[model samples]
Target: MKQDIHPDFKKVVFLDTSTGFKFLSGSTQGSDETIEWEDGNTYPLLKVEISSDSHPFYTGKQKLADAGGRIDKFKKKYNLD
Candidate 1:
C-alpha cells in the first residue's frame, strides 16, 4: 500500500500481429502507439507475436509427438520387450 511507487495500471489494447486480433484489457505495460477501440475510445496499443486466437494449442492445431513409437523403439533397442 505504498504511494507513488507503483507503475500505472490502465486499460490497453493488445493486438495480435499475426492474426490482427485486438482486445482490451488492463495492463501495466506502456506503449508509444495508440489505437481506437470499438467503444469509441483511444487506448495504448501493444502488439504481440502470438495470442490465443492464433496459438496452435488454443486453436487445436498443435501436432502431438509420437510417444508410443518412441517408447517401442527404445524397448526393442534395450531388449526389454
Candidate 2:
C-alpha cells in the first residue's frame, strides 16, 4: 500500500441510455454533472450506451443470423460443397 500514488476511487452513477436505468458504483473517473441517487446522495453521473439489462445475452433477445440461408453464399464464394 502506497500513499498519494493511487487514483481517487469515488462513487459514480451509471445511466443506461437505452433503458433509462441508473445504478450506483465506484470509479476513479470524474464527471462534470452530479445527480441525486436513490441513496439520497449526490454523485457523478456517467451515461452508458449498453448494459446487461438491454444486452442480448442476458435478455435472450439476440438477433439471429440467417445461418442456413447464408451458408450457400459462403459455399459459392469459396467453391466448397
Cα lDDT of all candidates, in order? 0.87, 0.83
Candidate that scores best on lDDT:
1
Q: Which candidate number maximizes TM-score?
A: 1
lDDT of 1 at 63: 35
**Compared with the true structure, what per-residue lDDT tens digits does model 1 show for residues 1-81?**
879998889999999876778999999998999999999999999998788887898998863344338768988999999
TM-score to true structure, per model: 0.71, 0.70
| Cα lDDT tens digits for candidate 2, 20-50 | 7788989999899899988789999998867
The clash number for model 2 is 0
Q: List the residue pairs that clash in candidate 1.
A: none
> In candidate 1, where is summed lDDT lowest over 10 consecutive residues?
62-71
